[model samples]
Target: MTSTQETTRPRDIGGSPGHWRRMRMWATAHAVDDFYQGLVPAAVPYFVLERHFGYVEASGLALAATLGGALPQVPIGLLADRHRLRWMSPLGISLAGIGAGLSGLVPAYPLVFALLLTAGVGIAMFHPPAGRDARRAAGGSATAMSYFAAGGSVGFFVGPALATPALDTLGIGATALFIPPAVLMGLVLLRHHDRTPGATAEKVRRHGTDQPGRFAALTSVEIVRSTISTGVNTFISLYWIRHLGAGSGLGGTALTLELGGGVLGTLLGGRLADRIGMVRTVQLGNAAMLPALWLMLACDDKYAALPLALLVGLISNIPFAVLIKLGQDYLPSRPGTAAGVTLGLAMSAGGLFMPLLGVVAGHYGPRGALTVLATVPVIAILLSTALREPVHEPEPPRATPSTTHDRHR
Candidate 1:
């Protein structure tokens, strides 16, 4: 490429402190999307009975909260690729907050569901752009996305914890109280929206123009793996609770432990992939899951279940960061779309298969259902056919300490 071409290409520069800060900011803006939806599964049934609404309507409300937030991810992702995502993140949060804040204010059924659907739209809009930015902000590493993804897990945990208390303190009618903090953050985002030197903007713009073919290639396989992973998680929760005689509290504990494991696994896995290679890290994580499968299937003790579940979660999520990073490497031009589709759509598509899982569960019982999900990692091991090591040559062999000029960068 010529000098003009080198200057024109948008190279990734996400490893710097400035980029991590941006990732954190995007994380906070998108937290609102996680908070309420996570709260919905617990609240939706209550909304039906307490309000004397029909079960179908309440279930519809629940589905809207979930799939609505996930369904439109790709379209929004593509748009954010072309524009600054600053306002989009905040606006989506504010809209969801408005819907959630007003959720308890109304007495009518139609309006309540309508507002939730609206809330769902906001979440859908918010995630793709913000997630894409996280992929970019991660500065081309799996560890970066780990930090970014952990924020959502934390937000989800907070949602139910906060909502349960808020219900008692403010009552459902006063849920609007939750909106203030989010709104204030949106305002702050507007004020702090990046207005850096044109050179920095020029660099980011150039990075956005990298190879699209690579991104789509990784995205295709990631979509399949992600879908399988989501199915596994959703079923595990249901099977353990219903058939294993685990209580709601235990189920929550299991899920949280799994999430915490995922956070750690992602961090370690990404760094390992960086040191070794993506395929190695991916294979190691998936293969490590085999023992966790034994524990999950055989262990009946509640305490035993928790730690095993945690290990399972770790193995499940370890591959995630690598997939997101690879997607960006493949499709240099649309990192956000790459991350959003796999994380959002592939995940949702996975959950969408729960009905089939339910059928299998009915035939073999809950234990059998969980076994089905545990089997999916085996498929992931097989589907990893497309994976290849990143093209960057391994760092050269080190010389003697006295002779080597060890510059870390």
Candidate 2:
């Protein structure tokens, strides 16, 4: 592997129409998988309204989902690395959908929490294997990975856009309506996996020496970024409705715009990383976040704040896909583990702080919670300083047939 290998076209994976088709399928499945994750936050405000839950209680739901999603990922990653787990993709998505769909159907808070937790576990199960396959399909191209990452961003965007109207109309029970996409997408993925030759036993061989120090630093940066992202996602609607005196519709609109910007930002970051280098892209994104947060905080007018929300989201996520790809670069032998931590644990770990932010929101309102969030980017910027470009030693020429067969055996 070399820099050229990292930046080149997907020719390594044969660059066939079939390869790209697989990439598209995985990306679509990513969107469907993540939609449930996004739905938790979208439905949180309604949970507050209908159940009359306190801020801390509302945040607890987030914590349930976060904890379930974050804790088991590393082991799952290890399993994905050692075996072909094509079944996990569809099974995980179906579980995710089932859990999220049932969450709002019940009246008890404990049951709601448990359902969301189940949904989170499904999310945990989906990422490692899905990410491993997506990376293989991408042929190590950051831009290609961004397309996959952008799928999650799109899912997050669509969650609020669709959930808001439905919740507004049918109330919370509308969450049940979201179940079908996940099931249908899961079936599609299952059918594809079964039809594709060698899909179940394709091996991902170990490569290059691992760089734990750099990967640790990268994970730290991502943890901070995730905290900020989760805080905003969990609170932005409430911020608009309570502090800015906006209606629920506008509050939901603000969230939708922010997540929509995230979709664009993920795509832009991928392209930018291909040109400027991943570390620089990470630093640049973190640096841009300061002013974006400040401007968003300063806006007194709700409508005017909407664009700033978009800017905030765009700047905040510019490093997201880059971080995920760079993590795999840093630990080349463990792409599954890299994706697990970056895509699952580090990403969801931020939700662990939601209860604390809820306390802040309870004390001084959503603005105060957001004000606390403004400090996170500075920390992310400092952490980005510790990241270095990973060196990829060139791979040996193709092995002989007997060598390949023996290795496979």
Candidate 3:
């Protein structure tokens, strides 16, 4: 090809040219999309207060949101893998925000359920394709992927902070305020997504070997960890309110410390993964969980629980990004499918067990519910020991001027 002709063709969707910039774009979109998810739980209290939803009814809302997102993800991931649909990211993120943001405006229980379901579907839509793209940009760097994961952590932290005041002063109708960020971020992602690159056919083929045993084990580990984490998130505030006689402000403060610890844990896990390898990092997180849980339980003082909450959050979340990356590596031929299970099914499936925990809490109290969480990490630690890191060839060097045209062809 002539020099000008070669220059005119867009760069192939392979290799790590401007990788960091591309990852940041995907991460920013991730943060925006997940912010809506974080809003659902935070809005539960308002629903009970304003809409007069009973415990069962309010829990149903959370269930609807979870089912909507979790059920559709596998099919969406399959479709994304087959089509590599570039438009999914923008459309998914926007739909997610709109559906979630509209929840407060609806009066009837049925309408609120429908809106939150749509939001969940939108969240599911964004994850598979966005994860695929982010992996391409990250070039197998667990640390970089952690930074991307950290964006979601930050968004979850920000969601309640933004939503509480709006709902407090303006009432449920103020949910409309959340819509603009979704629109803005969707437009921003739409502008750059097509320009972003994806994995080459060769790279995908090289690591295409499937390991079903390892995948199943990894998934089981996630289920255990997710179950424990979700239980803590659901009951930790109540623990403070009931056991410690803490006021509303202190309850919120406890949750904040937990989430803030997650942010720190994510960053730390990624760095450790890169240094000690993925399996060991997973092991480290699992091992730490028991002690953290013990510390939180032993502390009776509200002020003492605050710091333990941070420790528990860090231990629980440290393996998150590493697990996602490991799942992808294990099923390289089916990264989208892997993302569907790891990010969608495995994580949200844990929430399904909450009703059972509620049963436990009812009979034994929230402290008993939390006490059950302590044993889950032991299962995870044993499972982590069995995980073997998937192997692949080293990344090839980027094509230089002397070989650019040849490699492009």
| Counted clashes in each candidate structure | 7, 1, 0
lDDT of 2 by residue, 1-409 (tens): 5322333233232123543454688778888988888788789889999988889889899888878788878998889888777798798899899998999899999999999999989888889878877776676667778878888878867776678789999988999999998889989988987876443223333667789999999999988999999899879989999989999889978987888889989988887887778889899999999899889999999999999999988889899988988988887777778899999999977877887998999999999999999987899999999999877676555557798789879
| Full candidate order by lDDT, most accurate first | 2, 3, 1
Q: All models: lDDT?
A: 0.65, 0.83, 0.82
| lDDT string, candidate 3, 1-409, tens digits | 4322222222223223343454688778888988988888878779999999998889888888898889988898888777778888789889888998899898999999999999999989988877766766666677777767778788878989898888899877777899999989988988886564443523452345789899999999999988998899888888888888899789889988998899889878877887888899999999999999988989999987899999888878999988988888888777777888888889998997888999999998888999999878999999988899787644445456768667657
Q: Once superposed on the true structure, which residue ranges of model 1 sit more than 4 Å away at CA?
A: 1-22, 168-171, 195-217, 220-229, 232-238, 390-409
- Candidate maximizing TM-score: 3
Cα misplacement distance, residue 246 of candidate 2 (Å):
3.3
lDDT of 1 by residue, 1-409 (tens): 4222323333333244543564676566656567766666656756765687787787778777767777777888777777666787777777777777787788888888888877777777777666655654554555556566666656666777778777766567656877786677667756656642122222333353455554555555565556555555566666568877887778777777776777677667666776677777777776777667667778887767778888887777777767766665555556556656766666566656667877987898767767776677666676565567545323233345454345312
Ranking by TM-score: 3, 2, 1
Per-candidate TM vs. native? 0.81, 0.88, 0.90
The true-versus-predicted C-alpha distance at residue 232 of model 1, in Å, is 4.6
Compared with the true structure, model 3 gives a TM-score of 0.90
